[model samples]
Target: MTAPARTSGPVEASPGRLFRHRDFRLLWTGHTVSAVGSNMTAVALPLVAVAVLDATTFQVAVLTAAAWLPWLFAGLPVGAWVDRVRRRPVMIAADLVAAALFASVPAAALLGLLTVGHLLVVALGAGLARVFFETADQVYLPTLLRPEQVPEANARLHATQTASYLVGPGLAGLIAQLVGAVTAVALDALTFLLSALCLRRISAVEARPHRGAGTTSLRREVAAGLRFVVRDPYLRVLTVFGAASNIGLTGYQAVLVVFLVRSAELPAGLVGLLIGLASLGGVVGAALAARLARRLGTARTLLFAGALTGPPALLIPLAGAGARTAWLVLGGMLVSLGVAIGNVVKGSFRQTYTPHRLLGRVTVSMHLLNYGTIPLAALLAGALGAAWGPHGAIRAMTAWLALTPLILLAGPLRRRRDLPTAPS
Candidate 1:
């Protein structure tokens, strides 16, 4: 069965034109609020585990692992399911589930029953919701806008999301310091509900899902998505590179809080402030991504973006108390900036290039490897942190990150000025 055609506005719409798109605005607004909340949890969750529970470095890393473990477990099937439903509803449901799961954390804390075990369960639940929300979102975006407008929309979304990373942690730290980590978490829960409400209000209609003959079989549908990615040169290389980069990125990030608080002797408030300040580069990267792609070509922009993600990571391990902390800001800023640019470009490419019916599955198929490595990386970093120390773990992870950009060189990306507009 052929997928239904979607409505499109002018292909040459201006960058700010998406803001005038009622449904896109709703989606962007909802996503922005949710991103701020999620970033806050990135800081608050670890603080709860480490400060409140007195968790060891390994245990703190385990909390990070638990959050991402669901992608490894349920990602494939969820993708297939998303392909069979209205994406917006799936996204809304995921948001509600996440809200409930996050809300449980504070409720348990107030009952004097907060435990590492409980935190892990909440993390796992929220992660499951994320798997659903993210898969649906990737597919849903294309339905809401013209193909040519995707890069601009992605750039705008990435810009705001990165801006949240700059704001969320600092706010989380201040709130955590004043009230408690639990209170900060409670605030995060409310944000998820707000996101759900915004999603519910969007009136754009989704095309009825096209279920071709073999797609009724979940395993077959999943396999089709996997085969599409594995057989496509662009997706195949991108997936491998993404997986490699994530291993290094997630590995160091798993132990970063421990490194800052324990090894660098920074206060909780300062830790969040530094992370937020460092994330400022991400905002810049996102803002410039479209312009850079236009001038440098998407493929060249990616090569440059990939560079920013790697070598500068070395500066992170150099961070210590006082003046040395500036290294963290510079290093993290560069890494975040690189990641934001790559995300905007890659997201737009994937959305436009993949077959509409297979977008959900292909997106998840790529992420299955890309994000599946995160838990393993977290565990490895934790083990490294336990054996050597937070600094040693950070050094090892950053060193590994420094090498991942080389993976891109092995692919066709090195030969192209722009990614293919559509799969050949």
Candidate 2:
């Protein structure tokens, strides 16, 4: 089920010159714009649930679960489908669908029809669209640039995306503070439309999937992807590590907004400010990732980055009023730094390492486990918060996150300097 590599240009793109690559620019621009919007929703959506709907701790956590639950169910099939179609179209269509879904929230609010149930439905629908969009987005990158250019391109994307994390939350909080959470959500919807327009202008053409007489059936294609990931030691280990880490990451995150607003007594504006400023670490990570990988090797980079992510998460729960908030900011910054570095390295590695045809399926296959745990973790965190209080839940989740890096040591990554370029 592996598809051959396709590129828009014959020559390898020079490092840092992708800005001159028209299609890549368009792709990057669209993705960056949408990322900002998504980050905004990260702040705005929960605020809507908490402020407008007066959702309880468990309910807010459920809202988080609803947004990610689609990955558990729709991921594998959507991956297979993306492999069988033009990825750009899938991406464009996903943006449009998400735009409409998010837009519905504010509309409902205006009519006094908004409910936690309504938010849950919107989250689920938008999550489904994200499943499609992300799968297609991962597969589509290789078609625009050469293998050698992937790390650089990924670095650029990660940098901008991280920048959005820095910008979006603060802006979302300000908008939430000034106008309302619903208005911020409405603005997020418009960003999707803008992303779709940028994507529409890309000129790179994807080769249609060949349907030979012996072409694998859909079920077989899906199975083939699963087999490829399970049998490959590298993919297997990475998938295991990802799934393990996400449980801890999303668990803490599922309860963080509630903890910050309710227990810490931070205003929505200050919470967004704290989060956005802390996300500056991600920008640093994205900037340094390529240089670190070049000097330290990708495998070592992963190990080092993993270290940065885990332990400092403990500081997050130390946060409280006034000057003590610096603990959360510092802790979050360090953790984000690690996560960003890992994302750049892993994203480039996966894009180059996997066969083009299996890219979608394989990407989703890994994500299936990586993200599938999110809802469960959210529920668990919600329950924990209900039982121990938000601060206690934060302590429990961060402790789990701190231990997850050990999972990587069990894999062959410990022995290798660089990840293999392709399947051996």
| CA displacement after TM-score superposition, residue 166 of candidate 2 (Å) | 1.4
lDDT of each: 0.90, 0.88
Task: Summarize candidate 2's per-residue lDDT along 1-424 as a digit string, tens digits.
Answer: 8753332211134655778889999999998999999999988999999988899999988988999999999999888888888889999999999999999998998898999999899889999999999999898888888777788898889999999988999999999999999999999999999999999999888888656312668778788789999998878988888887788888888888888898888889988888898888999999889888877878888899989889999898888889999998899899999999999988888888898878888999999999999999999999999999988888998999998888888887888777777787
lDDT tens readout by residue for model 1, 1-424: 6453332211334866778898888899898999999999999999999899999999999999999999999999999988898899999999999999999999999899999999999999999999999999999999988887887898889999999998999988888888888888888999999999999999988888875733479999999999999998878888988898898889988999888888888888888899999899999999998888888888888899999999999999899999999999999999999999998888888898899999999999999999999999999999999999989999999999999899889888888787876666
Which of the numbered candidates is closest to the native, going by highest lDDT? Answer: 1
- True-structure RMSD, every candidate: 3.4, 3.6
Task: Return the TM-score for candidate 1, rounded to 2 decimals.
Answer: 0.96
TM-score of each: 0.96, 0.95
